[model samples]
Target: MPAVTVDNILTLPRIETPALTAVDRPVRTVTTAPTGYEGEGFPVHRAFAGIDMGALDPFIHMDQMGEINYAPGEPKGTPWHPHRGFETVTYMIDGIMEHQDSNGGGGTIGGGDTQWMTAGGGILHIETPPEHLVMSGGLFHGVQLWVNLPRSDKMAAPRYQDITGNKVALLSSQDGGALVRVIAGEVAAHQGPGSTYTPIALSHTTIAPGASLTLPWNPEYNALVYVLAGQGTVGVERRPIRSGQTVVFGKGDTLTVAAADTQDSRSQSLEVFVMGGKPLREPVAMAGPFVMNTRAEVIEAFEDFQAGRLGSIPAAHESL
Candidate 1:
């Protein structure tokens, strides 16, 4: 989905094949994401549904926001909301979204762009399709990932980072059979642009039919691979997986995925979102919008939000 691409993958840096000593991660579980609607009635796939919180430590939630083609006047986005104790990473593969926050962070991001907002302590923000996009709707596809902050940094000051597509590190599989777009963290000693409060690696990979990609992964981090489009097999055992499915990998130093020899006409290749992070290994208490370490803290967050302690909508965006 056009997050980023090169005319010739062979021109990009390649991820070296794992050494013979590298341990191959085995597939732990493969779960299918259920379809749902998100803000303003936009379609979404609850990418993290049914996955254990412990297995997703450092990652709280994830949503695959539409591969739908919206008709004119049909684009939708989230209303103003408050968040704390985590960061929200919005990566747009297509279409446009405008974001504004109470902390004086605002911007417009389009295809291949990413908005990284750390709602530490607390902040109010809203995401909406740009006016023009709403008036003349088109394809809209993206992913929003909720990354948990360590207890110590849960109350850190808020920050924002606008990472454009060109800023992402682009690499190719050892045989140039796949394109890997690194959005954050290091891949084969090559680092992406986004800074993270938690140690993590996030990448969107496209594998051509019949191709296999083996990625060197951090032994200490837990790995997950979510299929965005087409079909593929995961792990060393080569378990079959398709769109809307997610694979949680067991401990290992390398992760592998291979595309099927054929795919549906709608998707010519297998597209996957791969992410991993060092486990927080701490208690988690979450409410509707706030993630915290205790239920009492979650209640306190709601109280603060209602009391205007989080933040108020900016004057210019009051009409939104």
Candidate 2:
């Protein structure tokens, strides 16, 4: 049985994965960080590597990579904000994040932890980097994915998934991990947190030098790839996809990958995050820090915030 409750979050049933279709070439050179980025605290580098999610739908954005540093009592973090009609999935590589949301769901995710926050109709929340990076180099590195919600669930109740590494089952082999289960999409032997809301498959892996892995693709949903660690070549029909890049796939059943670097993964695993869903295909009007489907809606969201209607959010020093 699926993990469903009074929450009404239904995940698509799992099915058999098909064989990967090869492309003409491999992933080529592309812009890694497109959107402007800002660094807070003592981060090594803080910047965006793709289009601001406020635009794209179904697959809004993939934060190629982030390096979060720490400094005690600096209070370096984003303040309370509101998000409507979308979800935020944060996967951390190093360090922890203390998250608190208005939906009564929040927690601190340590290294290898995953946090999925669905800001259905509207959610007020804040995230702060752990104080560890402040002294002993509490560093933070990870990806923040933005997935657009369908009209039906746009205003639904907000929810969260505190996925720990221990809770997640890893499928590997002699070469390296075959799959690092993110939110396994009905796939067997792979299960990540937050599968109840979105039928999504998220994974982080290290394909050894000259290693190759063919992954399944969902034609019903849009597809994209974000490379984090060493350089690589996506086979069948991609260019030289290197670290810090995002790929907009055309159409296919499976994705084939070959390590671009033959000198072993010194940099790290072939870290990547793939996500897709039914498109919202509606007018998107965004302002300073909020995203809405239309201009009027955006105006109303700001108005609500000014009138103290956004809702209570967590803070670095405030009580939850």
Candidate 3:
């Protein structure tokens, strides 16, 4: 794939104001699933559909990358690729990943930072560990998620939102035992910096031992919790969950995550990402990198990509 050129650089668009609503949601434990893989590349866990595909509609895939050391000259990142009909969110927890897209957009996201890219119509792009890290060797850790687009907005122009970690709203519990970094949607009165095409909430939460919080969530959306570290219980049933597991919650408006208060010295802080979105529940047609509503639309994506209809990342540009 061609490197994104400096020409036609896209300006950052304004985020639409969110209509915040209050609801008293009931909390309950749902189901839990284990991670499938831990490897050398970007993705260490895959939970595309631990439940049913329809159970997590509008959010097709979830991947946790890194928390590994990449030695100098080792294979470390994804090369050029194409994506259509959805959005990709990359949230960095430890290191930096440089990205370039055909829309003359490219940048680096470091620890406590996020990049949300909408591959609406089509786009070819490359995401990799920064050259310095690849050459010098370093620790890389982060998460990436694929959010599906509704058929109605499948052909919208591609856009990117590169939000620094500081830009993400961080809310703390009354006791200061827990903190939530809202990436999208609303958490209490604090809203995320993300401009989402769908009504969704994505948050990274950390709770100290003995701390707990019950957060209000939209009832219409399906809720998911992926444990990033330590051990904890969720919902009213108090389902026990540990690192490398994902919990799928049934309908309700609120979620409770508690950090275990144990005498064991080895007990660690509990950190998790809680995400939920209203299901599109629409027909889905998917190929390798392209996802469309129909098989024919998928074919059209490939054809357009081949003909350069989507756009091209220039080969020589250094940054956007």
Candidate 4:
């Protein structure tokens, strides 16, 4: 049985149109900290990696992983782990990733593909590089985001969705200078392939030099943009941003991204991941791999994992 409750999943508000008259929202805050390595030695840059879970409610963690190139036989990846009360979204920009879970779910996602896994009640899963890739190492680049589930659906059954690049909704600027890939919400009247427990707009946008694109967004949602590559300006304020930087937006129904106008700029294109979601506005209790509304529930989750009630992945199903 699914762990998600009907009320929690069904009541999520959908934004079919802008709630406020379109206005160019300005950049509110910018975050850029040093990158670090985690998850079995993988290099990562995190967004809101701190402990204050409520600050990014409904969006717990975001890790931009491994833009590093590995020599032959030097690849590294994560081992098996358990999780609950949230969803894990892995979006690959380059290279490949293999995944195996307790529920007999296993697959490989390559460049431009995505895996959205819901660890509602609980599940043990492993995400790693492919065996061949480990043998003959290459480049690896991807991002993993943890989206929190509502209190009422914390114990819902787990699920998974593997979305290939072609399956994602794609939109482009009128002059073909910008492209947007809708991963978990609607863009240009097209919805993403993955089903979401909460209302969220997640997109991978790319823009060429001297180009600009405006996106309509939900006024009530908290919005943020993380620059993946190149330099660009965001919002009406034209807040300048570069790779490895994150820009938080203020209240408004529209935002703009403009690539550096100079043709001789170091970067030819600007790539970013745009994300926004409604805040849960509820207390959060989180431990390693577990998230809940209260400390008691978090304790119970750990107990369940220790008791093997969360299920375990078969060793044979996991790849290096």
Candidate 5:
């Protein structure tokens, strides 16, 4: 279990914003920004669904899901970018990604790999592929989530965590399907990695074909679910979800999901992300590449980067 006492990150926020103030509490669906698929900075899906961590801390947007297909010798990756006052949790389910950051963090993350970065003050990072890594059509799938840092720790130092498969604890249901984790909290018997950020539970779960599972939530936090593969029937309000879809629940007591019939019995499973903390009811003014409570803070973030006030990245990157 997470020894999440209030003292962990006191500067973040207190339970106030009803949206993420508590877990399992009933949550109403609210419309937020940065939704839709981006083939190249353009929207395809009318409304790209994102998870809003209800009544919880730091969790801002759940890029619910993304699938990138790469052709032979074709390059596809994220370049250097900066983020202040938040965190990014990238979970890889298929293919591989080479991660390099300005904080001197470098590694290659493969399927079932997770890279967690805390962009406290600020940081720049890039992700590329290795040579001969993918010749044919390689599948790149996963979720890139944005978690808002609490007000108090907005200026704290930055941090990073990379968790690979096998190292992660796994707890499965009797049928050997439907695995649960503590990744950030206590779920069943499995416990996830420890972190400087407490009171935050990140759950990574999967259900076998024709299996049903109900993820536990603390009305004391906010939660959301994204379907990785196969068909899933989510019953937050008797809702149904297909592959590549995300179901977000706000202020709800419980988040429920079941796998629908899959082709070839597909051995299917869904990766669900459950996150919540005290809601920061303060005003959120977000623009491209930045998120802050006010426009002035946003200006400062952008200006600092342009003036070289925030400099640490290598002058040149060694491509893979």
Candidate 6:
């Protein structure tokens, strides 16, 4: 949960409270994420499961990758894979991950770091734990979100951005009871470091017990709040929610969430991942690894990948 924190949260910039006339978004649906395994057998929570694709437009998928503590020699990661028509945003809250892609974009990201890879057109990449982390074993927690590219930019050139924790814009709730770490897009006039093809806002927020936060949101963008840990309530109606749950919000100018007065010992506060994006409103056709506008295009992507048009594993990483 230590994605980013300050010694005194009161010192951070405060998010202005919404005007009394502002519309508070109502909760549309609250779904619980099912536990699963991803990559090389690492645990994950399918954060987007059961949500409608239309509701998640511009956001294809997401996975909450473990709040688990691994033992020595138990770390796992994804094998080399090809992706197209989308961007993969991997944000590490704890532990370390090394990434290498065919387009000559690669890096090591640790706690509070992010690796944003745009697999536009096509690209091959692999994510794995560093050798030392594998040998020593430790806590690993992170989130990977797939952002869809508009049809016009689906075939654009690939790109990468490495965003360190220090680059994230940090802000406090009006009452200083919450810490908001903006990873991408703008929040109350402050922008995050990661660039995005789709207009979106992503933040990790920690709310102290019994505290409430009201966030200004784009009226045109769809809003969602995913609870990563602890218990809380969302919307003005005060719907109860807890870890592994995601709250989809209806149209509005503001979003509200309040932590429970008491939490389990395992989690001292309520941690949530908030996101919203302008709807793409385009037809979506997706295969195992490729997201496209048509099924035929998805088949073509697989063909190209198998034909070596996507990319090859770097010589140095061939052994991995």
Cα lDDT tens digits for candidate 4, 50-70: 424544667988888867888
Model 6 lDDT tens row, 1-320: 77879999999999997898999999999999999999889999999999999899889999999988999999999999999999999999889999989999999999889999999999999999999999999999999999999999999999999999999999999889999999999877789999999999999999999999999999989999989899989999999999999899999999999999999998999999999999999999998889999999999999999999998999987996
Off by over 4 Å in 6: none
Clashing pairs in 1: none
For model 3, state the Cα shift of residue 41 in Å.
3.4
Could you give the candidate ranking by lDDT, starting with the highest? 6, 1, 4, 3, 5, 2
Q: Please provide, for model 1 over 187-297, each residue's C-alpha lDDT reduced to its tens digit, 9 standing for 90 to 100.
A: 777899999989999999999999999999999899999999999899879999999998999999999999999998989999999999999998999988899999999
Off by over 4 Å in 2: 1-29, 35-56, 68-75, 173-177, 184-191, 196-199, 263-266, 314-320
> How well does candidate 4 match the true structure in TM-score terms?
0.89
Better of 3 and 6 by lDDT: 6
Runs in model 4 deviating more than 4 A are 1-21, 50-55, 262-267, 315-320
lDDT of 2 by residue, 1-320 (tens): 00111121123233234433333223333456554443343332212344444323555555533554444554355567777767888777776677888777888876677888888767787777655644455455776777666656766787887877666545543344334344545323455556644455566654555666666555554455666666676756536766666665555565666665453334544555555454457566667545667788778877877776766654544653
Ten residues in sequence with the least summed lDDT for candidate 2: 1-10
| TM-score against native, each model | 0.99, 0.78, 0.85, 0.89, 0.77, 0.99
Against the unseen true structure, what C-alpha lDDT does each candidate score?
0.94, 0.58, 0.75, 0.80, 0.59, 0.94
lDDT (0-100) at residue 317 of candidate 4? 52
Question: Per-residue error at 106 for model 5, in Å?
Answer: 2.0
Which 10 consecutive residues of model 3 have the lowest summed lDDT?
Answer: 1-10
lDDT score of residue 94 within candidate 5: 67
For candidate 6, which ten residues in a row score worst on lDDT? Answer: 311-320
